[model samples]
Target: MDALHAWAWRPDGPAPAMADGPLSGFVLGVKDVIDVAGMPTRCGSPLTAPDPAAADAPAVARLRAAGAVIAGKTRCTEWALNDPAPTISPFDADRTPGGSSAGSAVAVATGGCTATLDTQTAGDVVRPAAYNGVVGLKPTAGWATTAGGRAVAPSIDTLGVLARHVRDAAAVAAAIADGPALFAPPGRAAAPRIGVLRDPFTDRVGDAVRACLARAVRAFSAAGADVHDVSTGVDLAAVHAAHRVITFAECASLHRRRYRDHAERYGPRARELIERGLGTPARDLQEAGAVRRDAAERLGSLLEGLDALLVPAVPEPAPPRATTGDSRLQIPWTLCGLPSLALPAGTAGPLPLGVQLVAARNAEPELIAAAAWCERVLGS
Candidate 1:
């Protein structure tokens, strides 16, 4: 019943609103890593000073222009990395709510906000939505401007949304995207060509998640979707390895000076990542970029005839508060910079399970439509 920890700060009265548009009544929680004019962006780390920002991040500005009420700044993991936030899952207080967009997901799931602006370098947005039983949408890299936000991995870090419904998530995305039609809900496809990915990444999910995926597949088939089992054919392991190297290197690059001067201020996980990045050879970083580009091409090709690729959002339901759930299932899509959507599919006892849908780059409309259809079919 106590979820105050989810918010880093809240206004004494209603937060200011902008001219009315599609999101006139929407209440949005901005992640701590993103700037909100007049509010301090702490990024849930002691490394940052609590200085009020002069302007809003593009994502926040766009949402505000669309008439969304800025609820407050939600908590995030330190620098949106390995460290977990203090937020607790509404489903079970003893379990983790996922991270580093932990507070964003928790706010949406608990009805504290209509939607939230979040950032995802790996599985931060979708993983947390899955764990908290909400809807998450990560658009193509560069689709939503990351200006005015802290970068975890500039090359891969992306702005995203978490909402109680797929349509709400789509609305938020459409507002900030370069193309107004990016996530505008389109007419439902008569038969969505859904490709269910079967790879080492998916093979690692636990029984509950496996069963949840199976149930989703059945629902899609029953709803007249043309579902087929498929593979990306790219070396997933190599892609994941590349993701880590790139993320760490970029993060370290961003924090090099601060870390060098005050290493004691960082959490253990963040410190370890920076150290790894500091030690990584330039040749290794370049090779990782090559691997990433090659995998992106192969994965994009795999979506040639498919409306969306499906997979479990996480390996299992939210675990104990000690750590966030695994991000293996989401890393490949994120690395490829493809658009993905996560929807609550079922439950494991008291916790929730989710399925992710991915589409080719710049295919946010298709991805949103497909997710909406699945959301309907699953009755989530």
Candidate 2:
């Protein structure tokens, strides 16, 4: 591994690039959890054998076809859970780069790659990108397939991208998305209507993040965008609780066989999640599903008349490497299956701070356009 510990696997020589396409010159890093032909998909876990994948995952194939070079497999939190990866923030070595897509974010941050394939169950993609000062785009759930990757939370797992710019991330996402046409070149929005989320979400963030969000709101307003405060109406705390129940239950379902036979091989956090999931009652899982649906509906309603809802991407800047920062600010949108983008807003001292922009389900085009506009305003 390099000093930053970004890559888990690198080719003996540079990976070949395609002659030409939309992403022709882009160097892409695949998250270790995702398959890349001829490379082992270790998922940052010792339990998985080092047998090379026979084929590229759908998302990887799509990006390759669009002419992105496969640089290598980047590290991920073990099983894409809470366990921290070895990668550290490029800005501050002692601070976390976030997870489970830590390597993906770090790779993009340090120019190790132009873009990276990432996934989000809770805040894997966005959080890391925020900490590393890159753009993380989590499309609406199911917009991009999760077929070839290990599942953390089957229903909520989303394929996303981490890159240095909104356009780069948007381009990578468009190439792999189910509805490619939905991501037409991100045009600058014309006086976009944006909502600044308050109460449940904002109340939890620390001073630095609050300042970052405040600056973002002001920038958008100054840029001629119609900005106003808004609420999700749904109880976000309840939604977060439901998200855990579902994530744990589904994750346990996927790893039951392996966990039962080689329990000692798993990391503490991953092991705890699996154990809790195994103990959760089926009725509770069902109820959690219900809560998810209800919350999604309410949040979707909140998006009407608004191009996007803005909020802090993380509760605070990246913390010590002992753990990934909190994911509460990101869970509600992920649970609701809305498209969200994290952009570097400003710095919290030396640490990078980000603000998230959320749009209704299947509205990635609008989300990207709005984000592009905000990216210009923030000058990030």
Candidate 3:
């Protein structure tokens, strides 16, 4: 924050003075999960209090090297869980801004910052971006490592970005991904083959969301893309169950002694989640891991010959300030560790709605290419 404050505080920064050279010269909001050397990483918890970090997360380092200014840490769900923060909606302060990447999305949406870093275990990145009508891209798992910061569900956790447009998202993603996927491509054919998931995945999404999805499909099809719905026969209920087991187990291990020994200091939701994780039987956790591995493999098989799997990123739009929006719409894909992007489709009353673009595991470059093309066609 000092750097951002310094920039905002003095005439040396771009906001106060013109840039001396060519660069994007944009300001960026870094998610709390990512370390920006010398900045405190509260991760939205009272106990895990703020302290300066020793190094800039690789993502931050690259952006700075490219001349982007760090805009300070944004509010997040405590420990990146369901606990809500004080960041009220910019659209309607009475509503939730969505979390755990809440502030990052709002920062971009409200034009307080040009871009922001975000992370997702389940829906942290996409849901918030959807709620705020911005673009969020979660590249393939492991494409960007979580080396310098906290981890809630390491297996599914990914470093993502929130920006106003697909091009900005792509540029930032390139700066942070496994080197830009060798040459970026525009969309494929006249009819970009998109598979809309059937059954379990689509069934859970709410009515308004379904309507928005249909609009998105029509937009793409009208733009010359083949938008078709298909069923992969993947049992998402089973996938969700397995996901909960693995994520909680991993979260529990991360918070093990802190949860038990420093019980009072932990946030209510995170504390309870950790306790529950400890109680889960070892056999159940083992079974969950096995299930997840099988699911990731099967997901690839199911996505064969497809460009992207289109679905709702969240079940509904942002809910009341009482809690964050739903995470179910994202849980299963996270379990499979596939890349997903949440693009704002339209509005649901005062809140924003989103669509997800899923691709086979590790095929992020292609997924992003398709998304950029979709954004162009939809004019999103």
Backbone clashes in model 3, listed as residue pairs: none
lDDT of 1: 0.89
Which 10 consecutive positions of candidate 1 have the poorest summed lDDT? 10-19
Task: Score each candidate by Cα lDDT.
Answer: 0.89, 0.90, 0.77
Q: After superposition, how far is residue 193 of candidate 1 from its true place, in Å?
A: 0.5
35-114 per-residue lDDT for model 1 (tens digits): 99888999999878888999999889888888899988999888898888888788888898999999999888889999
Ranking by lDDT: 2, 1, 3
lDDT for each residue of candidate 3 in 1-380, tens digit (9 for 90 to 100): 32111111111244432233212577787877678777678787767655677888888887776667776777777888888866767777777888888878887888877788778898888888888899888877887878877899887888888888876787777766666642143445345679888876567777889899989888888887777888866677788888888788889998887777788877677777888888889999888888788878888897766778898888877888788878887887877888888887888888888788988877766677778778777678
TM-score of each: 0.97, 0.98, 0.91
- Cα lDDT of model 2 by residue, 124-150, tens digit: 988998898999999989887898888
Question: Which of candidates 1 and 2 is the stronger one according to TM-score?
Answer: 2
As for TM-score, the candidate ahead, 1 or 3, is: 1
Roughly what TM-score does model 2 have, to 2 decimal places?
A: 0.98
lDDT score of residue 171 within candidate 2: 86
Could you say which candidate leads in TM-score?
2
Off by over 4 Å in 1: 1-4, 14-19
Judge candidate 3 at residue 314 and give its lDDT.
80
Q: Which residue pairs clash in candidate 2?
A: none
